[model samples]
Target: MQQRFETIEQYLEWMGNNNFTNMTWDIEATGLLDETSIDYTASPYKIKPSYKHHCIVVEEHGGNILAFYDGPTYVFDGREYTERLPKASSMLHTEEVVTLKDYTPVEYIHLPLKEFKNYVLKRKIKRVVAHNMINFDLMSMKLVEDMDFTIGVEHRDGGLTTWSADTWMGKQVVFDDTLVISKTCNPDLFGGHSLDKLSRRAGGDTKIDFRKHLAPDVRFLDFAADMLYYCIYDVKANTAVWHWLQDHEDYQLSDRDNYIKNWLSPIQLEKKVAEIITYQEHRGFVLNVDLCEKAVKDLDAKMEERRARVEPVLPPRPATKKFMADYTPPKRQFKQNGEITSYLQKFIERIGAQLKEGDDRTMIFEGKEYKLPLPADVPLKTEMPAKIGDTTHIKQWLMGEFGWIPSEWKETDLTVDQKKIKLPMENIVAKIDRWLDVTYSTAYKEERLDGFGDYMKITPRSTRAYVRQRLIDRASKGSCKVLTNPSFTKGQEKEMCPDLERIAEQFPFAKDVIEYLTFKHRRSAILGGGMDWDEMEDGEEPEKGYLASIRQDGRIPTPADTCGAATSRMKHRKVANVPRITSLYGAELRELFGVGDGFFQIGYDFDSLEARKESAYCDQYDPTKEYCKSLMMEKPFDVHTMMAKRISEIIGRQFNRSPAKNVKYGLTK
Candidate 1:
């Protein structure tokens, strides 16, 4: 009979002697997958094992090898082997193989890169552990050899992997990774859950700097010894860390809470989340891409046309030679012989000529006097055009030449040459040096498309208007119950319908533009009508579905955190109801998330669960002993109406109106 091992050390010994399995985890790849190429229908890029060296560490016998090259190799049980490296540098050698008898038989086997996958499949290994195995090792295997390995059993509960059905090995095999597990177990070690750190924490005897051996072009013959030793040490360290976790009291307590209390282990929950996230990533929402593109193009053309109308009104050149020159006006002048010198002296003299020496020249309008500074004594040149269109040009030229211009002027109040003006500075400069400015209103016609061909960014006001229009559209049509509820507060309704007239009067042309934008924003899940094609594969259409991410704290977030809700009963900040999407989104948009082929969505809720729980708790503490009984009555009492009637009875004596009217007034109160 076999002896049962009770301790971790004894179990490890048993595993080493009889139940152990070997797996090589390190990968030599040119680079990570291009994220931009993955989206909608295409999976992330997979690395091919054949393109780089393969290192395998055998756990049972503390052996390691570097394979996939034509060099001196070993064979075990008629299988072709690759070069063997010394195990003295391995951490597992000190712990497991150092005390073995010299005459004990030890077999080292290595195969070509192409045969590695076949060997793993043939061995029927039950559990394979590695760090970051899902992204690096397993993804590389799937990409290179088209093999599918299950990570957890719950992931197979739904028909999610039906696409990979042909390549999926049976449930007898599963791959376990330590990256997420370690992070969850040791969250205080934030951002320090790398394999090296975990190995040290687990008291491993050896360490290797694996990044130093990444010479993909170098032949395996030159670095086999070091590469094999590093691989073995990594495996040993990973195993040690995993064993440490299994024996850890805190980890065990957490596992028990997750299983016994939550009915799902942390690993199971993580797998479920990964599955959902992957599905959502692959199943992107459908959009009317063609409609959006056309809308953007038409809006761009309209904006350009409007801009062209205003282009002829602007001046082709500076209004004065001073504006064209790089000269700057002096700030002040010093006094000479009790008289101010430079341009300031002439400016002050001119001001004294126009008004009393002690009083400044002022123009009074609307109960306020605006001081108009006199022009400085600067040299002037004839730079104005012979024929100008409006008074703005006269002001521009005056400002450039004399560093002074009338702060206020009307189009009808000025002459063509600005000489016959009815206000101050009427004849300050010669008519040839004055020009008119075009009087057209200067309004900005923002372009619809940006430099990248996406819609122009909108202001927060416009965003609010878009949301308001959506709510109003839904409410007016009686399509949404929440928006159209008669009892709902005015403030809540105003959030979605705040003074549309103000918006429309402010931007008359923007009404149609905003309507088009609202349609694009609400119909499609993307704002500004910009679809991220890089989220999916190059040529594939986005999948018609929604994706959500489930956090460990029991919250699931939709894209951009726009929508989310909690799963646990515990109170959380700003917890939302996930099912409210049905109420918020229109039917056409909601229908996009149809059940995929061979699968159906099952949704259930605890009907009035909170109200019942509240009633029970109240009854337990009630001195009257009637609250729970009243709640449990078959007919069910209208608590609000009953309270209203009781209040009406108390107040009806003061009123001559009918009892029904009294109750109605009470209910309103």
Candidate 2:
């Protein structure tokens, strides 16, 4: 049996078999396909045929796939083709294998100058294809001298070879049917179309090589305005051809228009061509640079002209105001004080202030008496104030609500207890400018505020500053949690806190406090600041009176009581809802007034079809009366008339002009 097995092994060995099919892996090969010695070489790439469950081996020479070895010679599932190999080899003969070949036909023609001239001299060939070749032939020959083997070539006629342009350029086409030459060709106006770019040449260098113009990422913004130039070359043969690019009329608009339109500029088009040239480095496809320059110049000129025509011209201003001698205030009528009172309340609220009730109809604010309704939350007190040393404005007092100082509040009027809360603006101006450490880090740790156990070395200012900066940066950057789906509810905010926590870590100082304060604490705090009608109407009018001072210099109202009232409301807002408070006035208290630019304007008209259709803004202070009637009714105290009359008196004193006549309407134009 040993002698018989040895004879069988010798017979199998002579069969020229090495197992390409394996026991360790699927699919191995035996030596039989070498051109030099019939030694089978393994394929460089594994191939997956559409129907086959196993990967086949494919071989290539010079980037061209030549052949693939068929499978079933190797079974992947625990079956050893190596062990079954001798039996499998019994089915194959040497004649069954076939060699693969490159099938792409060479289309370009190339020849030495002598051969090219001779061919021209003989005039045997009926036609020749060249793109602007009359002048570019010599340039093409120079390029070939530098990139010899890199240029793909195939020998067709004896001593003459054709090269495939597609092989080097990937795939390119010259569109000619859709070419147009109008102002529209000036790229800026009609871009983001099917055609990449359509530009015209005016006066400039005509020697621009166009292959240089192809961008790595094609930026054909205006299909109609850009010129898509494609060139095919067989440089050694001194031959080249070009196609005039045009738009495909039937091409559809895509969602990517916005992204691509910006790249359609004349300058961008020139850069794009250069980009393409860089991408195809080994292939010496130099575009016509002179033509590109010409196109750019022409585009610039056209753009200038378009601008000149469309540029707006301001009409000369009238030398004098146009007025009719008979002109009168439009149908003066008494406006109901009810809407005016509500409007005043809303307006004051909009300014971050509220109305407080007083004795005998006086507005009580910070223990002071005022003729106007003071902000509801302001404390009612009357006492001498704490002293501010060596100050230009004795009335100014530093308040403790985040860089907020009531400019109108007399520092002397603040009691000694209140004086402690006053932060000196001048003394700390430099420190504030330098961003000094105001946060009580060590103290906060000592106090052991809830959720701050991790803070050992961290300072209060450092943590608060970090949180403040994070909030500031987030607001400045307009960062917002994307509420992607309607199903997302408030419950998910706690879950979302982890997401904010990650963001906070990226920004030092935010810790988790900033995130908690903004997302969770904002709305609830604002609700707490809502008007407390009971407090405002509770107190009685006083002997001494205070009225809102109208500024004669066209400045916004700056009543001291109003300022005090605003500070109180802001304090409540901060305590109740920091996020909503920040939203209304930004992170810093000073920025709310300072950044908003002193003027306070709020519009609350309840007209319009949306209001009528949905009754969106409809909410009854009193619902028994008709909506229009209730809206138009005056306040029982005639607040509007009284306020307007007082304001008119102030204006007359300053400008010697009466106030504009008040007007009323029936909720229609």
Candidate 3:
């Protein structure tokens, strides 16, 4: 500590505010007293010896000295009681009673605990500020639950004031921010085990890291956005008050890395937290049905399986009511409403997935399946007198002796002649016990044992269908009412054709044909023209919407009639792009090829010229035409054969066979 008082007046002023002592340090009969003696000040405000050694040293500039003890009553166990003591002060402070009504329950499920602690410590903290702290405070304090406490006493006016029950110490506090005395305090005396200390209990050596465990990017401020109700301590009023911390983006707490942060962010979680508190405050604890069932079923299956493996027909009597009643199953109780059944159901489902179905047979459920072995027989004294060790040998010996029958048949088959049947997993233990009793009069042999092998060897891949079925089963059980997956049901497609027809009926001119020829095929008389459909404008129409028309009932429309008229143009212009033809075969083929001086063009010209010359003078025989009379003298041309051969060549190439190989001509050589 550092002391800085320029003048004596300044030093005295400083001394008045702080509970420090100087030259005025006095030795009262009870002990040493600092200038100002307050109740419980020594225990609550005084520094511990360990911390005093390492606490920031006070230079001449600043230091704080709490009331201290010097003379002490040495009244120990059997020691000489010779010590000085201080006389009692006439005035004493009374303890206040805290009631449940005094506290305002924390409205928000999630809180920025670190920031809350800092807020408390920012100015000053005195005695524990809790209402009905004897009970309600204790319950609320359990919410954050990572703090420690120790007993301490308060002193006032140099006398013993009051005995503080539990002083809280840590970055944790519970406050019913509404009532003045409704709060629990955790004083951070020693550091290590405070609420800030991390524990390794969750895993082998690593603590469950909230930062790694929870979703990132979430904060307490985000949770407070929808706070239901909460409380804050009014240090000035020395009272707790209630209000919602909702929508307070500015009031963010620091160091948020935990499930509490993430779990509380959702709106539903906020309601759940509050409901749980309310329920707990009303009810003590909850009953967990699922945990109870699982424990009982697991133990029963194992016991049954063990009994099924032994042999030789030793049978134990049926389980009695007294034995069954002695078994106390595990229980789990939800601390919240609307949670008990759902939680129990989920737990049951998980347990069923993990449990063995029955003795000596496998069962299939939800794709993954299980098989349970019969329990080994643990023979009671009434059933068999042989010790457990002897039973093992008895079972093996009987199995070897009964090698005449297969193991399965011997174990399960009914022997009508003998009027008996080996019962399941029980046969192994019962028969073994019987044999051991006959073979041994005393203790039997014990053998070296090895560890058990892995119990789960098969893991079924969970298919979509299996999950869907399981969900259906859960729904059938009345456990989950909502079908979370949307695909579980089919959606109906809506019809659009009716709406399209309605629009078409409103535009009447669009129903005609060839009515678009005017504007659609407009040609300039002076110059070959172009029709432009792009230059159209949209205009207002009836209540339905915008409309357009084109060519207006078969009359040619100029640019003036074309405003929105083009809509009907496309309707009647459906056949406008067809081609027209006026030429004969050779001329049409030449035009089709679009060739200049090409073979088709030349052929068309020769055919036309020869046709004209023949028609001109062929009334009987023409002197104007030279019909190639020389060709008559030459061998007659076999045009048909040539044409046939050409056709055959084309067909052969197409069919991929040889024309020459398939064709025959008489005396062609």
Candidate 4:
């Protein structure tokens, strides 16, 4: 007959009497120091280990018996003795308090760290399951020099849903994680893969709130009783969720079917992705600090030189003037004072004489009898002309009266020697135009460099601040307050400031700058842009590196979803979560990604991958027909040329003319 233990104490006593090793485990670390205060960048290995408050192990099947262990002090055969806590720190840290109102701690004989390790080694433990066991619990245990026992058991992680049981130095151990298991079962599960959430979703009543007891810095001995209970509860909850998932018939059936079809279950695929990501993270990417610093310095010098050249041409701040209130067109009273009232009235009278009675004569001012005059030459009354609808006639009248000639408007003939006519505030307007062009261009260059510099030594967060400052500086140059406003749009700039578009057309730099900014702002499905860096380590050398994060769908992506493709056919060809180095245009910029010592970069891609796939699919759907046989057989077939020829044949015309010439003629006709 087998003996059944009701409590953890009884279980420990049974373990002492007879060997029982296969178990699920969890550990609670109490009184951890704040990592923010530690200088990990300067000396990562020097950081002190966090104190472990309790370690709980529950048997996989032996009546679900649990064994609890605590540290800083342990009692052996009724004798109390001191012991050091495990060196590995818990990944999850909190400052929450532990509640003990209704909880009771089980009393059992304690084994010192050495004895505890020996007892487990002698039992020849077959499996050890825990959430985040690899990076935390087992990692901490491995740091103990005296406890050099081979982890011969299957080590499992419930958080990341990954496992490794490969032997190190002739030791064989199995590892697995439950995170991917739960995620694959239900991707849309409300709460994430946290132990508390999983247990609740599995209909278990166990709730171990780590935040309910000790402060992050509190000693483990002070809260040993409560910590032990909390640790045990976590193990029980984790095991319960695992069991629930295994017992679910629907989940088992679906998982089995998927495994049979794909040769790997969804969870297994996710595990593979996780493994890749872990390896990449461990092999951190390199940074070219010197090159980045030099680039930024050079950019700053160029910006200053550009600023000096443009500042002289920028418009001085307009004088703050006051004037008497005046009437506008249609005889409406002007609420605001201005100097243009007399000029506006004269313009209105001239328009009235050209107006016809039957023509559409809407008042410019609401509730006013004054009607806008229409040109006598107006050919049609059915459609409103641009001159009338857009109020361009008033603008023409003003230009004629003030002798103001638009800088961009040119005569139809190329032989005409244009006269430079100046009008009221013409110099100021020209200066503002110049200012806008230079400032916008400067802002664009600065933003590009600032974004790219983050990959070097500069932090992305700080670089973002610098980008904002550049915009603010540009806005301060003139009355360009719109540039600083959050809601400002490029289209609005043309409307609010009439000269912006004209300047953009006249100055190639201005047009290029705006176009470049627009291109950078547009969202794309592929990944490209500045790189992100982890904290700098002491003695770490600059080198080329890569980063990736695996999703549940087995695709890797950066935070922006910039990478990660779903198709297996092209997955190996596409480099996800990294910049497209081959497509980068500038030679100087491309040189930054040169392979470092001991590392070699290589590139290979399928030819016409999408076209090939389409062809294959078409053939598969209809075996009797060869839809793409001729094209497939033709080596190095130019699809673009083939399509262009087909289009010309269908249209019954040859497209032998330049696109620009075609467009010019098309528009003229």
Tell me, by TM-score, which candidate is best. 4
Tens digits of per-residue lDDT, candidate 3, 1-669, equal 223332334443554653321110111111111111112123233322211100101111123321221122111122222211111111112221211222222211121223332322332333333222322233232322333333333334665333323344542222222111111111111111111121121111111112122223221111110111111111111121111111113322122443124312321222223334333323221222333344335434543443333222333433345443322112442334423344333433543433334422342334655332212232111232222123233334333343211111001111111112113333333433442343233211111000001221111233334433443443333222210100100111111112223333432221111112121212111012232211111121111100111111211211111011111111112112112233111122112222213323233223334334434554357453333231122223222234345655765632211222123121121
What's model 2's lDDT at 302?
Answer: 45
lDDT of 1 by residue, 544-574 (tens): 3222222222222233110111112111111
lDDT of 2 by residue, 1-669 (tens): 001112323323443643321000011112111121111122321211211111111111011111112211211222222122222223432122211122212221112222322222222222222222211221232232221112222235886534332111222211111111111232212221112222222111122232233332221111110011111111111110011221222221122363134312321233223223322221211223333344335434544443343222211221212221111112211134422254444434443433454333343334544554334433222222221111111111111112222111101111111212223333333333222232232221222222122322333344555544433333233221111011111221222222333433332222222232232222222222322111111122211100111112211221111011212211221111222232422233222222124745452435433324323244444365344343343543232344445555764632111111122121321
Give stretches of model 2 more than 4 Å off.
1-163, 166-342, 348-354, 360-669
Q: Estimate each model's TM-score.
A: 0.37, 0.14, 0.15, 0.43
Answer with 1 or 4, whichever has the higher TM-score.
Answer: 4
Per-model root-mean-square deviation over C-alphas: 22.3, 35.9, 42.0, 21.1
Off by over 4 Å in 4: 1-13, 16-22, 29-99, 104-111, 114-120, 124-127, 134-140, 143-174, 184-189, 205-207, 212-224, 253-269, 298-578, 582-669
Model 2 global lDDT (CA atoms, 0 to 1): 0.24
TM-score, model 2 to reference: 0.14
**Superposition TM-score, candidate 3 onto the true structure:** 0.15
C-alpha root-mean-square deviation, candidate 2: 35.9
* Lowest lDDT 10-residue stretch of candidate 3: 52-61
Q: Report the lDDT of model 3 for residue 82.
A: 22
Indicate the TM-score of model 1: 0.37
CA deviation > 4 Å runs, candidate 1: 1-19, 22-24, 28-110, 122-126, 134-136, 151-174, 183-189, 192-237, 252-269, 272-288, 291-669
